[model samples]
Target: MASSLGKLSGRRVCSVALGSGLPRSRTLGPAGGRICLSALGGTGSAQIRGLGSGSGTGGVGAGGGARRAPWLVAGLAAGLAGVAAAAFHHLAPAEMVPRTEVASSVPDKADDLALRCSSFMTQPVTALSELRARPGDMKTQMELLIMETQSQVCQALAQLDRGATFAVDRWERKEGGGGISCVLQDGHIFEKAGVSVSVVHGVLSEEAEKQMRSRGKKFKTKNGQLPFCAMGVSSVIHPKNPHVPTIHFNYRYFEIEEADGTRQWWFGGGCDLTPTYLNKEDAVHFHQTLKDACDQHDPGFYPKFKKWCDDYFFIKHRGERRGIGGIFFDDLDSPSKEDIFRFVQSCARAFIPSYIPLVKKHCNDPFTPQEKHWQQLRRGRYVEFNLLYDRGTKFGLFTPGSRIESILMSMPLTARWEYMHAPSENSREAEILEVLSHPKDWVH
Candidate 1:
């Protein structure tokens, strides 16, 4: 259990120091260093402080504005109690064990189910080519291909949201990568969404090729690491109505084989959620659902990643976190291609349990515009983190042949930037503020 817990931590929570860059879509803090993210005004130090028991927002900087107070714990405790009540009433998976938890059950290739997702999605390149029968040239073809592919991806994501009770409305490409961006908005469930998947591969530049050869890495088909091709999915979802919160997940497979048919394969992916308002009952429900899936594969797995998820998403700047975090991991070097594939499959299997209930339970709950405004404001912070500091965005941008649109797929549909705005006193928005200002565990 401890080993699994540690791995889960490495996969999810502790990594927030690595993933905190996702919120604003812009880099905000110093890399691998502390910066302040406390509610509006704070002590002008790296420590996150002064979040409140009520809706917390803008305040003057350390210069002279009214200082915001640290988050409220009692309020959180009360809310957590409510959440526990909610979870007690909801359905939760049992402690049943699967027929096999041994690593041997892990598959050697990409799971048929995941590869099948491609089939559900219409291939845009072909559809565009056919539509442009009398078209111009390669550049036009590439442009049309990218646009059409994005459209398809957008539609697919919308369908997923609609089916799950989330709303994803506006999404525009950031223009640069062979990626399609999408967002979910203004729904009983989801509020903001950022999701995109990219496929990139090419011949390495001389400098890059030198680095590859130095590692003795070879190219495809009995050659050198001169050329390569890759693909994968990545995404983030922010729900509206604070009660519904946010979530993120991704799954991918990569490979390299030499001319002699010798090949190396790997699998990488993860799924997690961030709820601004902590509901321990909800957290337990969410965690337990994920735990069931992990147990199906290995009962020992749950404790590891659960703690990891908790530890990872901390926004040290604020002395708080983006939300009650889920799980995160990358670059899985598997013992065998099959094992790598199974690992990817196992992670993918956990997504439904992680988020479905949040939407079902809260989508129909009544919420006011004022409360939504608070959610949007929080979404703004999310935007800040993603744009300013997300490592994935940095990696995709700096890496040659990276698709920018896909790299930035984790953005919200609607966000606010008020010179100085906040929720009304004693409002639902205030309720949300109470949670964000001071972090709470709903399930606990």
Candidate 2:
């Protein structure tokens, strides 16, 4: 008797049969598309056809089948069950599998993203894997942006200097997160340039909270402590040539989780210029570049933030502004988080375009010892303002886990203070002082 077991082409198959007393089995190569289980007086055969390529037939001897038939049938049944399960798995629909299971199997894709992230000046304060895991998170997005901006600005400055590259420092805070600081000092072109990015989270101290409240922040605290997270990219570049002008810019995001589990977030920052000798054209170009970036988001942003920059970077006791103003804004949570992020991104990207051209234009310009002295005097004032009045500086100093080096990276390499020292009246030095005393609108 011969029993048909159906086609097995391109599929796995198993079968069992009983005949005479003998019991034996053999596997077969591809033989047409049909499979068969046959039994005769002296022989029994089970053939698997089209299992792969080519063709053949297989058989089992039946001499001892009477005694071993029951055991053979039981063992073959178990083997057939296993083979059926494997076939079901191989032919199962893709939708039947869980999405996470599919994603977890592709580690090569995750590694590729990590490799791309490594191109930054240093590794991110947050792990790349975590960043990949939370693509929609604002915190992750902000950290990645600042790190990328830091790397770009450092590379741009190094290209212009052609002699020195930034020295990288990666540090961590015991309390929560960490940061990367890149500095290029005493280069052929840049006197001192520092660009840093930090992602830190911890409980806000009393002084820090007081400062925040003073700035109009209202937070619900738990037991007099507020949990906060801050991340930003800040840079100050002072060129070797006094004519090149100094530039400073910082953009940041902050979040505070209230006692009730509610969260409040905001963005803040700006860019400004300080010069030993006032070059009207350079000032105009710098302000115009910033204006263009702001105009893309809101036309009124330039004028409003420009005034804020003037007011924020002021030397109160000296009764003068810090530099030719660009733009400054704080406590911004308006329009929409996405809209504000795009606006901030636009402004951050404007740094290189706004300032690098001025460097290229004035880096090779001639400068006298007197002008250098004037530059040093201006730097002295820069130090005074940052140490005494800069809110970011003060906040960083007050924060327990903040990196002190990054907080003070904005300070110039050298500065000078002389008793009752004054620039000669109506000279280029005094002219800049006059502008500093009275801020001007470089663009219409």
Candidate 3:
């Protein structure tokens, strides 16, 4: 049977008796250093000493000449052991590790990783047992990454809000696979925020197939249908303060098995911002963070994807963009699966540093009722782009047995559409509209 240990703070201590009848103890420090303590049985005096890597002998013992009674030495060792035991007991759940089993078993590396995954906000769509069993599979690896990303983003947003926590929903599709959706609504800091991860498998619909084909995806189909699996983490955060920009991000992996039993896959997603009121500093910071992440992988990525985002999120009918752009890419199966996965992971990790500071800086900024109305109207534009032009939204809606709530979680809670609405010339609202109409290159 396999087992795990509780959270052991500081160092781990183990005791053994030497052949010379002296009881020796070794403590493993956090950084892999070791301390060895031995007591001379006859004198009942203990020598507290340190040991370096591969060292045969201990260092000079502290208080070498001091003499102690046998009973005292015994009592001291027993007391220290008791304190260590108590510390372990109070720190973790009682069922995490049994006291009787600690000496006989230590958690292996696999168990440690599994324990971390188990700490996610909600149970993973794929069973933990299956994830551990198929560690080498790309599908399993992508699922784990998305789950980890979802938990991290959700936790970060909750901390910023300080008053409201996310409500989690775990649902399984009747066809195959499932997902976890976390939403925080009507909070003091955020009006609506959703972070969701899904692992869904099904046959692609003709509409979806056509959409993919339009993007240059080549597929060999039997009976005009292709079986596919898709997994990703997506988030849209709508902050209450108009000054704080709303942010959206998604990173996903897609695979389809062709009629000839051949398989093809790709990765896609990006992060962008939509602010009601323009802030050059905020826009620059957000784009710069994303650029740095992209630069680490490839210098060409930021420029290419930034323009793609600007074009992809455009509200074509309105003749303007959804927001000041970030990076967006799709049908990315190049450079090898492993390489692309790593690049996607890097982009996913960049979300926090890119957006959190803007929130902290403007979450408390003052605004009037008119400004609030302007914010709502701006959100109406956000709604327009997502529903009408967002590929992910369309794909989700077209999928069989898709969760409607999770698919629409990207929409802001409140929005207004006033016909013939336009900001006054040279007003702050007009400033943002100008930039949206003609996108700016914030990073260079």
Residue-pair clashes per candidate: 78, 9, 0
Question: lDDT tens digits, residues 9-66, model 1?
Answer: 0000000100101212212233733333233233222221111111323221122222
Segments in model 3 whose C-alpha atoms lie over 4 Å from true places: 1-110
Per-model CA lDDT versus the true structure: 0.41, 0.67, 0.67
The TM-scores of all predictions, comma-separated, are 0.52, 0.75, 0.75
Residues 15-114, candidate 3, lDDT per residue (tens digit)? 1111112234333334533322332122222222111111112111121211111111111221111212112222211111112322112235557555
Q: For candidate 3, give the lDDT of residue 356.
A: 90
Clashing pairs in 3: none
Task: Return the TM-score for candidate 2, rounded to 2 decimals.
Answer: 0.75
Report the lDDT tens digits of candidate 2 across residue range 1-444. Answer: 000000001111223221111333433214422222332111234321111111111111121111111011111222111222112222211111111211121245547656556556646778766888998889988888888898789878766764343545445566777665566655566667777777778788787889889978899999988998888888888777788888888888889999999999988888899887899999999999999999999999999999999988889989888888899998899988889999999998999999889888877666667777788999898888888888887777666755444666777778999989888888998899999999998997
lDDT of 3 at 232: 85
- Give the Å error, residue 406, model 1: 2.7
Q: In lDDT terms, how accurate is model 1?
A: 0.41
RMSD of 1: 20.0
**Native-to-model Cα distance after best TM-score fit, residue 279 in candidate 3, in Å:** 0.9
lDDT of 3 at 314: 86
Candidate 2 lowest-lDDT run of ten: 1-10
